[model samples]
Target chain A: DVKVTQSSRYLVKRTGEKVFLECVQDMDHENMFWYRQDPGLGLRLIYFSYDVKMKEKGDIPEGYSVSREKKERFSLILESASTNQTSMYLCASRSGQVRGNYGYTFGSGTRLTVV
Target chain B: AQTVTQSQPEMSVQEAETVTLSCTYDTSENNYYLFWYKQPPSRQMILVIRQEAYKQQNATENRFSVNFQKAAKSFSLKISDSQLGDTAMYFCAFMKHEGKGTYKYIFGTGTRLKVLA
Candidate 1:
């Protein structure tokens, strides 16, 4: 089975602290994404990487950054964690090699609480 | 920009009954994909069903099926023989085919479904 593994299931961070959420996929998928899920906003994309060392800002990328050093790993970074940033973060991956439409495999998600 | 809407925030259905979750989307692209994703209490999102815009026939998977209306841009998911395991948050997503395997998904706010015994 294809798996998207998120490093943390739950996290608590102090305001102004830098935070890192890691995601790794074993399927060799070339596309990785980071999204933050909030109550009314649903899942808003923050960043995505289509290839190693290449990243693009999604709809909501104000306080977030991403790094894809290798094809298998993608990391979402919170430069300065704020209380407003508290939400459930999800990591997803899809096969770039696949033609046409394909569904994404998402990780279990990381619920972050900022104080 | 593409946007997905799931107006029903919560829904309840009895076992063996059927429930349909509504989803509507707005996009200019002619070719795209629609999907229903289930996020269980464990917080893992899984694909339940998918529909391609070019296909006129509704897609079905076992008891799960979709009612895709291309003209109205509506893609609803119907779950038959509801089970306790079916209780979860369902999200409607839209992905515009960018060609060469490049696309991004826009998801709805989600509908929470609870199956009663």
Candidate 2:
């Protein structure tokens, strides 16, 4: 079974705090992604890494950064957490696939709240 | 670039019934992939079914099937004997065959489904 694990399930932080959300995949997938989901907005990609230390900006990348130092772990960082940053964050990984196996296995999302 | 659309913002099915969720996409590329993903309350998104644009036949997985209309760029999911566990947010996604290299997904605004016990 493929397992994608997030560092936290629920997090609360001050408005000025720097936050880190970690994701680790045991399946050795080559592609990983971070997405923030809002009520009616569905899931919007923040960033993605196709390989270790290689990253690409998605549709929304402002106020966020990512790290992929190792092949199994990807991290999403909020430079300065804000009230607007409160939402469900999801991490996903996919194997070396071009089309048919494009299905991404996702982690149980982390719901973060900024005060 | 490709875009996915889910026309139904919300849907409901009584337990043990059948339901269909609509999805449409716009892409100029001929060979691509379409997928249906279900995000339950637990916030874990799971792949429900997949459809390849080049394939003429629809795809199915037990109770979950898809009606793939390639010409119209339409991909719809049909759930048979819908159970309470089937209630979730269903997202339709599209990914282009970017050679034999990498492929990225473009997802739709999901449809929220409710199942009555």
**Model 2 agreement with the true structure over A37-64: per-residue lDDT tens digits:** 9977878999999999999999899999
Model 2 scores a TM of 0.96
Q: lDDT per residue, candidate 1, B1-117, as tens digits?
A: 788999999999999999999999999889888999999999999999998899999999999999999989999999999999999999999998675655768999999999999
In model 2 chain B, where is the ten-residue run with the lowest total lDDT? B96-105
DockQ of candidates 1 onward, in order? 0.89, 0.82
lDDT of 2 at A29: 93
Q: Which candidate's lDDT is highest?
A: 1
User: In terms of docking quality, how is candidate 1 classified?
Assistant: high
Q: Please compute the TM-score of chain B alone for each predicted structure, in the order given.
A: 0.95, 0.95
Instruction: Give the TM-scores of the predictions, in the order they appear.
Output: 0.97, 0.96
TM-score of chain A of each: 0.97, 0.97
- For model 1, how does the per-residue alpha-carbon lDDT over A1-115 read when each residue is reduced to its tens digit? 8899999999999999999999999999989999999987889999999989999999999999999999999999999999999999999999887866489999999999999
